[model samples]
Structures are given as structure tokens and as C-alpha cells.
Target: IDAMLEGFEVSKENFSTNFNGELLIITITLLSFLGLYYSAEKLTSRTSLTVSSKPLAIGLMIAIGIGLHNLGEGLAIGAAIGLGQVALSTFLIVGFALHNTTEGIAIASPLAKTKSPISKIIILGLIAGSPAIFGTWIGGFFYSPYTAIVFLSIGAGAIFQVALIILKWLYQSEQKLVQASIVSGVGVGMLIMYLTSILV
Candidate 1:
């Protein structure tokens, strides 16, 4: 949501000329990601496996989404540093680190019941994190608002897809779709995120 809003804010600055084109770009990028994700999911499902693949698949999807989002974050960090906003860069780094701590849980929760190896877990962690390095490099060296908008939009799309997948999974797993525990869990998570943002 935040990433999408940021992209929207960026679009507003160029509303006279680029806004429509940016929207098209965002829509296309978002749909492309969704298509790719579903294709990959279908391909993986056809393969035979020793363990249940659904959880692993979900974890991987979550990792991918989080990775995209973190890449945008990395861009912000790199842009800050590139522009010599040292204090802002440091603040972003700290805030991102604190916020990302919870991403570990998000990535791990689905795999908790599975016997996925340490190596697999490490790979997933990398998938969710290593993009920040690339993003930082790009933002530092070739920072462009247009480029940022695309990446941020991509991140927003991926995260939205992940959220939908989770909700579908939750609906399938639970007897009641809107259980109190689920609601409270979401509320608590939001509260925590809000508090962390305050710190940032």
C-alpha cells in the first residue's frame, strides 16, 4: 500500500505528461508479475515431491514479494546516500533493519511445519534479502524517479499478490474465515508496524 502510494505521489509530480504512461507501465508490470507467479506455481505443482509443496511454495512467493519490496527500500537507502543525506540514509537503514526483522517470521511461518532443510531456509532468506544490494547499487549509481516508480509499483503488485494468496490459504485452512484470533493477529501486526514506523 505504501509503495503504491509512493508511486502515486511520484506520478503526481509529472501528471501533465507522464502520468498516463506511468499508470500503463505500472499496470503492465503488475500483471506481468502476477502472470509469472501463477505460471511458476503451476509448474511447481506438477512436479513430484517427497513433502507437501504448498507451504514451500507459499514461503517462496512471500519471499519474492518481500524481496521486491526490500529492493525499493534499498533504492531509497542508496538514493539517500548518493545524494549525501547521510543522516537520512542511516535512519532508513536502521528503520529498515528493524522492520525486516519481522519479515523473517513472515518467510518462516509457512515452512514451520515442513522439514525444509537449513540450506533451503538460507536460500529463501537470500531470495528475500539480496535484491536490496542490487537495488542500492542501482539507486546510488542510476537513481531516477521513473525507475523508482517502476520498481516500487512492482513491489506493490507482488505484495498484493502475496496477500491474496495468504488470505486464500487462510480461508481454506480455517472453518471460519473471519475468526477472532485471525483478526486480532492482524491487528497486533498492524499495531507493531505502526509503532515501528513511528520509530523510523
Candidate 2:
């Protein structure tokens, strides 16, 4: 969602600039993110060789991924408010507040399954969720297209890495439903994001 929507704005603005090479910049930014996601996934997957603190590491990885993704969401809100799109921003806030309930499930479920301590889970929850508020503060005051582009790309990358890891985990479980679940999950997530988009 971050990459597609924000990248659209960036590409359009760049086009309006008569191809001032912002398109190139956007392309490079996206490719960089894709590369980063690939590298991170490769590195993290190698952790199967290590046993100690595996659960803690996995929990932290999920938290970091969630934080990165929400940072982009915050950027959208902050950017909209910065542009004086009050109605859009308000709708976004309302939509996001509702959407975040599901996000809370995503953040907590893996940690709970790992039997992480309650205190640690609480702390991880904070780590996973604070970025939207913080990003809003930054975006509202310091909003820049390039900045948003960079952060959004990074966030998208982090989110992809987490998804890849989760899918890999599910694959190792030898479940016949892996492909269907992945497809269904993607469809549902896209649908939700699309529904939220109507608020704008």
C-alpha cells in the first residue's frame, strides 16, 4: 500500500516536473528496498542454525517489522495533514484507529505463541505501535516527498521481510493449505487497504 500509493504521487509529481529524474530516483529507491528486504530475509533465515534466544529474536523481528510498516502509515497521515487535507487525515485517523485493532493481533499473536513474558510482550507492543504517532509528528511538520518516499520504501521492505519469514515458517510446517492461506491473506489485506482508501 505504501509503495503503490506514495510511489504514484512521487511518479506523478516527477512527471509534472518534466522528467527531472525523480522517476529514476523512485526506481532506485524501490529497488534498494527490494534488495534490502532480500538480504535481510537471507540473513534472518540463516538463524535456524542458532538455537539460543531464537524466540526472542523472532519476536523482536516481528516488532521491528510492524514498527517499520506503521511508520509509513504515519507518514501518510502526517503528509495529508501537512497538506491541509483535514477531512482526509481525519478519515485516515478514524480508519487507521479501527485498522490498528487487527494490527494489534498481528503483533501479539506470534509473541504469545512463543510464550514470551507478559512484560516483554507489553514492551514489544509499544515498539510495534509507537511509530504512527511519532511519524505523524514528523510528517506534519517536516513532510517532504522524498523523505516519505524513502521511509515508505524502507517500511515496505521491512514488512515484506516479515511476511517472507512467516510464509517460510508456514511452509516448513508442511501444510497443504500454505498456498491458499498466502493467497487469501494477500487478497484480504489488499481489500482492507482498498476499503480504507475510500475514506480519502
Candidate 3:
């Protein structure tokens, strides 16, 4: 959600001169996200794995979503550095590092009951974290606001899809629409994020 908002804000600031181009970019991004989600769903259904497929798929998707978000973060870091804002870059690096720690829990939660291997977990971590390197390089060298908008939009869409999946899973598991634990957990999570955002 934040990523999407940021993307739009950037577009408004940088791409206002090219409204048609901006609209096209947003349309393509949204369609791509829908395609990706459906493709993932199909792949998970067809693939055979030693562990349960759904949980592993959820974890993988979450990793991918977080990776996309982190990519944007990396872009910001590299952009700050590229522009010679050393202090801002350093602060972003530290803040993003701290912020990303919680993402590990998001990736791990679904797989908690599975007998997934450590090697697989490591791969997922790499999937989630490696994009930041590429993002940094791109931001440092190219540093296009247009590119940032696309990446942020895709990240936001991926996260939104993951949230839907998790909610569906929860509903199916409990056979109910809402639960007290879910509400409390969501509230606490939001509160924690808000506090962390202040620090960031």
C-alpha cells in the first residue's frame, strides 16, 4: 500500500508531463501483477513437492513480494548515495536493515509447520534479498523515477495479492470470516510498523 502510494506520488511529481505514458505504465504493471499471481497459483497446484505445496507457495510469494519492496528500498539507498547524500544513505541503510528483519518472520510463518529444508529456506532468503543488489546498481547508475514507479507498483500489487491469499487461508482454516486473534495480531502489527516507521 505504501509502495503504491509512493509510486503514484513519484509519478505525480516526475511524470505529470506525460500522462498517457504514466497511465500506460500503471496499466501494464497492474495487468502483469494479475498474470503473475495466477501463474503462481497454477504452478503451485501442478508442482509436486515433499512438503505441502500451499504453505511453501505462500512463503515463496511472500519472499518475492518482500524482495520487490526491498528493491525499492535499495533504489532509495543508492539514489541517496549517488546524489552525495551520504548521511541520508547511511541512515536509510540502517533503517531498511532494521525494517527488513521482520520480513523474515513473514516468510517463515507459513512454513513453520512444514518440513522444509534449511537449504530451501536459504534460497528463499536469497530470493527475497538479492534483488536489492540489482536495484542498488540500477539506481546508482540509471536512477530513473519511471523505473522506481514501476517497481514500487509491482511490489505493492504482489503484497496485496499475498494478503488476499493469507486471508483466504485463514478463512478456510477457521471456517469463519473473522477471529479475535487475527484482529489483535493485525492491530499489534500495524502499531509496531507505525512505531518503526517513525524511527525510519
Candidate 4:
């Protein structure tokens, strides 16, 4: 496929596929939502700055989960670009960039409580997120089904583990109201997901 340089000029055929790549993309997207869910849960359950240290670790874990998912999304972007899917490439960049900004705040919130040195916090945040940059570059340069599948699966697994951790933390919380809210949020999120999956 010829490289597309202009808006609306990139053929959807070049960007769209029915094979492993598209499946991997969708899988990564769902997992990204899982990360978002965990992040919201953590923020609501406990503040990193004002809450217990136990939940602080959970918050960090959530950040890690988001980072991994973002890496897979980045890989999709790169892979699409590698295939000359310019419009898809642009979409991925914009979406991921916006997601990353929110992730930065989510990650920094808890770490801010530690009163940790700015240098250390910066390093940690970058460490958590740097993989996405490399993953995207690799996916964009080489079209490898095996690589994409492996990274996508790994990313999803990371997010899933964090979700489990969040559940456990919620279960252990002493406040009934907080626990109820967490349960309600998760129930609503899952219901919305079901409806959207069916409708979309």
C-alpha cells in the first residue's frame, strides 16, 4: 500500500483488517477500559495522598496496569502505521496521547503522597510508561503477528491482575458504604460494557 500523507486520503482498506491485527486491536481496547475501571476504583476507594499506604501500592499497580495496556495500544498504532494505515495511525496517536495524560495524573496522585523526590517520581512514571513508546515503534516498523499477539496478551493480563487486586482491596475495606459504591460502580461498568458490546 502506498503511504498516505493527506487527510481522508488513507484508504480504510489499508487501515482495516479482519485478521489477527484487528482482533488484537480490539482486545487491547477492551483491556484499556479495564485499566480505566481499576483507576477509577482506586481513586474513589482511597486517595494516595490521604489514604493508607496499603492502597498506595494498589494505586501504583493500577498505574502499571494502565501502562501495559497503553503499550499494546501503542503497538497497534505502530503496526497500523507500518502497514500504511495513516488515518488509523493518526487516530491511535491522538487517543493514546489523551489517555496518557490522564494516566500521568492517576499515577502521580499516589506517589505525590510519598513525598518522594521529584526525580524519583519522574523516573518511576517514565519507567511505567516508556514501554509503550518502544512497543509502538516496534509495531510501526515491523508487521509481526506473533509479536503483536504476545504483547497484547501480556498487556491484558497485567490489567486483569490489577483488577483482581482492586477487588480484593475493596472486599477488605471496613466501610460498608465504600464497598457498596465500589460494587455498584463495577456492576454498572460491566452492564454498560455488555450493552455497548451488543449495540456497537
Candidate 5:
């Protein structure tokens, strides 16, 4: 099959199904997000002399990461619905809904440590939730493996940055018990996701 995209031929042989292209995109996207996060952290530290701004920025950054992650989940749910897999779509919607609730807490946990206002928490919740709905709408009409890969890559980049920032917070707290619990939580979360994948 002939596939023309942006004046370039995108064939099965030439597209990112190959290892090198996939690696390049993954590396570039991850590094770019890391760079962005690093720069933002530095710039915010320099400019934000006020106390409130920093927390708001941190909350917003976390919300963005979780939002992108949820959007990827929405894409999966939307694609399933698009493909007429009603049962699979339903299962995914329910599962993602439950998963995102935990994700919200993950987003909130750092801020919860601080004295965040109720209004800010509500805003972050909307930021994290709106993307899923938007992504589902987008996914219903468009179906492309390449597009999905891009979405997933961006989401992974953002989510990884959030994890790194949280790790730094954990280090600062100097609470061994909290760190151990985090490690245990990671193990349990991975196990659950692995088991759930088997169902699909």
C-alpha cells in the first residue's frame, strides 16, 4: 500500500515500525520533556520570590503530567469504542475511571503536604480530568498507530518527570518509612497493571 504523508512516503518499510526510528522518537521526546522540566524549575526558582507561586506551579506541572497520562488512557478507550468493541470500551472506561482516581491522589499528594487551598485543588482536578474527555473525542474519529505512539510517548515523558520531582521530595523529607512505602506502592501498582493487562 502507498501511504503519502507530508510529502514523504510512509510505507511499512520506511515508517517507525523499525527499531531505529522508534528509539529516536522515544529518546527525543523524553529528553525534551526532561529539559523543559529542568528549565522551568530553574526559571521558577529564580523569578518566583513569592511563596504561593511555587506551589501553584508545582501543582500545575503535576496536573499536566497526569492529564496527559489520562489522555492516553482516553485514547485507548475511544479507539475501542470506535472499533465497535463495546464491551472492551466499557471495561476500559470503568478501569480508567478507577485508575485516574488514584492518579488524582498522586497529583494531590505532594500538594496535600503543603497548605493548598480548596480552590486550587478543584482546578487541578479539572485540568487532570478534562483531557481524558477530549482525548476520547479525538480517538473516536482518528485511528492511527503512529498517532497513538506519539500520544503515549508524550504522556510517558510528562509522567516520568512528575515521578522524578516526587523522588526529590521524598529525599528531602528524609523519612525512610515513607520511602519504603513508596517502593512497596510501586511494586503493587506494577503488579496490578501487569495482571490487568493479562485480562486484555
Candidate 6:
């Protein structure tokens, strides 16, 4: 009977460890996607600088939506780290840093064609890109699954919202292909992260 009891206790400990590990992994994985979500926010705003009155309204809407989405990402990051998945969380940080660089360039490309002021471009870029830093710190500290999912859904929704803005901007224009390309570029960021997870 004592031996059986000892085995039961061992099983319980193992179960706890497995549960913790799974939680950590999911939290970190979710945080990785969260970082890209905010990075998209930063990148999308750069495309708004040359818009006319109507497009500017759309731009502002996109920016506001993306900002809220980014806040959600910050929460996910915090929740993930809080759960103790530091390594996976770090991987998210590194991947997002790399991904955001490309995103910055992609977002700025269309604006570059319009001869906008460098200051305006830089300001928009910084506005969009800086949230990654905040999100990273949050993911490194807070680690929670419920928080992560909440942010994930918000971020996903914001991206879809911005995609609509792109569609509107491209409608009935010679630049439709360019607009489509930009939308696809954003998806590329998502795809890259997904592929990286496979490597892990």
C-alpha cells in the first residue's frame, strides 16, 4: 500500500509538471503571433501618409484599430512570461524584431513614392513600430493563456479591419496591384512566423 501511494504521488508531480510545460508553450506560441500582430499595426500606418480626405479617415480608423490591437499584443506577451515560458517568449521577441524591420520597409515603400517629408515618415514608422518593445516586455513578465487569447482575437480582428482599408484604397484605381501587394506583404509576415514555428 505504501508503494502504491508513492507511485500515485509521483504521478501527480509529473502531471503538474506536464501541465505547467504545456501552459508555458501555448502562452509563448500565442505571444509570438501577438508580436506580429502589433508589428502589422506599426507597418500599416506608414501607408497612410499620402491619403486624400476620405482615405485619411480610413487611415485614422485603421491606426486606431491597430493601436488597440497592439495593446492586446502587449497583454499576451505579459501573460506568456507570467506563466514561465521565458525561452519561447524570447524566441517570439527575436522573430518579431526581425519581422518588423521588413514590415517597416514594406509600409514605407508606397509613401516614399509620394515625396512625403522624411520627418512624417519617420514619425509614422516610430508610431507603428515602437509598440513591439512594450509588447515584448509584457510577454516577458505576465504569461497567461486567457489574456493571450483575448489579445490574439483582437489583433486578428484589427488586421482584418485594415485589410478592408486596403481594399477600399485600391478600388477603382491604377494602383490596385500595389495595394494588393501590400496586403499580401502583411500576410507574408504571418507566414514567416508560422514557418519559423515548424523549424522549432
Worst 10 residues of 5 by lDDT: 1-10
Q: What would the per-residue lDDT of candidate 6 be over residues 1-200, giving only the tens digit for each residue?
A: 11123223433445565455344434443464455546544554664464543333343445544454555545544545667777866665565556456545544544544555667666656655666556656656653444444445545555555555555455634565656776787688778757654432
* Model 4 residue 45 CA deviation in Å: 20
The CA lDDT of each predicted structure is 0.78, 0.69, 0.74, 0.59, 0.67, 0.51
Error of 6 at 91 (Å): 1.0
Q: Residues 148-200, candidate 4, lDDT per residue (tens digit)?
A: 56566657656665556555654665445356755685576566444433322
Candidate 4 residue spans exceeding 4 A from truth: 1-60, 169-200
Residues 1-200, candidate 5, lDDT per residue (tens digit)?
A: 00112102212345654445456546645774786588558845864686656656666777887787667667777888999999999888767766666577676776766787889899999998899888788779885666665666667777777776666655645656456777887777777665555443
Ranking by TM-score: 1, 3, 5, 2, 4, 6
Q: 51 in model 3: Cα distance from truth in Å?
A: 5.7
Candidate 3, residue 55: how far the Cα is off, in Å: 1.6
Q: Which prediction has the highest TM-score against the true structure?
A: 1
TM-score of 2: 0.75
Predicted structure 2: lDDT = 0.69
Model 6 alpha-carbon miss at residue 64, Å: 4.4
Candidate 2 runs further than 4 Å off? 14-52, 173-191
lDDT computed for candidate 1: 0.78
Q: List where candidate 5 sits over 4 angstroms from the true fold.
A: 1-21, 39-48, 173-184, 191-200
Q: Over the full model, what C-alpha lDDT does candidate 6 score relative to the true structure? A: 0.51
Q: C-alpha displacement of 54 in model 1, angstroms?
A: 2.8
Q: For candidate 3, which ten residues in a row score worst on lDDT?
A: 169-178
